[model samples]
Target: MLPWDAPLAGRLDRHPFTSELLRGNPLGDPHERPLWVYVPPGYDDSAERYPVIYVIQGYTGQVTMWANRTAFRPSFLETADAVFAAGAPACVVVYVDAWTAYGGSQFVDSPGTGRYHSYLCDEIVPWVDAHYRTIPERESRAISGKSSGGFGAMITPMLRPDLFGALATHAGDALYELCYLPEFGKAARALRTYDHDVFRWWDDFRSRPAFTKPGDESLLVAFGVAACFSARADGTPELPFDPVSGVVEPQVWERWLAWDPVRMAPGHAATLRDLRAVWIDAGTRDEWFLDLGATAFRDEVLQSGLPPDRLHFELFDAGHAAVDYRYPLALKWLAERLAR
Candidate 1:
């Protein structure tokens, strides 16, 4: 295997996308963002419309990270190219950016984060279909991501079955009690130094290089997701748990639970049943215990009446980080299943 950049058999086109919904976002994040669309080999030579797989990112991830190369493995961009080059089914892959001042928008709409979910389903999907030779149907579209991206992948299809038909989630956040609750206590302890005020820690975090502090990850996820899931009417992030006692506030916590994919499955069973394919996986030892979440989500999907053959579930031997290698695996799987 080549240790460095490999030539792609496909073409990745980068475009500047301006979002009307994000123009005056609460965080004042930029309305213009990078959008990447990758066409598989032979795209130019043929007049065929291909299925599209929309790729989103985890927390703190933006569009360009798809090109980031690690030590031995190539980036997902390269590996995904290889999937089509080797003849798994051809697909047009889209990389979306939903970055926020708090690091991620969780791909949801909120007073705190703005109308990101609508920006994606309404703006980006239509923009891709209008610009590309895509099949332009839900069965022809799939979304994939890892971690927070995975969470988005799981929920997007559920929320908008008209736009997405299949999905692949790698350690996607779910089972709030298992994946998120533990962090509340750790964040509370970290808040002790900031007078139990996450905004104070946020101020400190911005004052220095990112993630330099002890509880940066936990606190960031706590605050950022609160901004996505439980923000108040005036756009203030309300912690689902008290910062000092680490006790979950019932009303706010229920708001967070409403966004949980595991909990969301029962209500969206019709959508889940309509799905053509679902790929779910996580490391057996995911640091956030998302493997448990993955398992619970799989159970929910199965119970929702999706056939066993249409679903792919696995538990790998690794952890949360460095799982980019798995992206192409799911990509190839979804490519074979998405309507041609």
Candidate 2:
């Protein structure tokens, strides 16, 4: 693999999208965000409309990271472009931005974060359909992402089946007990320096360079997800556990559990049954134990009455990071399955 940027057979168009839904958000994040849309090869020569796959990012992920070139591997954009160039199938890929001051919005509409879910489904989807030669029906549309983006991918279709009929999740967050609970103790130990207060840690975190201190990631995830899942009506992120004692707060923790895809799947069985395709995969040694989450979710999808043939499930021999190669595989899989 060459350590340089490669040319794409398709075209990537970048736009500045202004979200009225995000205006005056709680954290004062930008309402106008960067949006990248990729039209597959031959898009310019033909008037053919294509299926679309919307891509989101994990925690702390923004739109531009799609272009980030690591040591030797080409970015996801180059690899994704190659998927169609290799004649898998053609698609229009959209890269969405849902960043927040606390690192990520978890792609949910919350008082603490803003109407990001609405911004995606209501604003971005319509805007893309209007500006691109895309098949606007739900059967022709899909969403994909990793980690928090994976969580978004799983839930969005369940919540808004009218807009998305398929999804691909890579180590998507789920199974709260395994994926999140252990961090509570670590965060508690880290917060002792700040008098067992996460807000104090937040204040100190802002005062220094990011991740310069220990437990920054754990605390950030805790606080950021609280903002997304358990914020008070007035918009303050309420921690699900006591920072000092590391004790689970049943009510608040239950709120977080309600968003778990494993728990959510049974309720959205009818929607799952209607999906055209679903791709679920994770690393065998995922640090978050999302591999187990993937298994649980896949079982839920099957139990929901979705045809086995319509689903793709796998656990690869890898971990959470450096899974860009997996993106194109799912993209190709979804492109073939989407309404053409």
Query: How accurate locally, in lDDT, is each candidate?
Result: 0.95, 0.96
Residue-by-residue lDDT tens digits, candidate 2, 145-237: 999999999999999999999999999999999999998888989999899988999999999999999899999999999999999999999
Candidate 2: deviation at residue 136, Å?
A: 0.4
Q: Give the TM-score of candidate 1.
A: 0.99
**Model 1 per-residue lDDT at 43:** 95
Least lDDT summed over 10 consecutive residues: which range in candidate 1?
1-10
Scored against the true structure, residue 198 in model 1 reaches a CA lDDT of 92
Model 1 segments beyond 4 Å from truth? 1-3
How many backbone overlaps does candidate 2 show? 0
Alpha-carbon RMSD of each model: 0.9, 0.7
List where candidate 2 sits over 4 angstroms from the true fold. Answer: none
Each candidate's clash count: 0, 0
- Candidate 1 lDDT score at position 124: 97
Tens-digit lDDT track of model 1 for 1-340: 5777778899999999999999999999999999999999999999999999999999999998998987888889998999999999999999999999999999999999999999999999999999999999999999999999999999999999999999999999999999899999999999999999999999999999999889999999999999999999999999999999999999999999999999999999999988999999999989999999999999999999999999999999999999998999999999999997
The residue pairs found clashing in candidate 2 are none
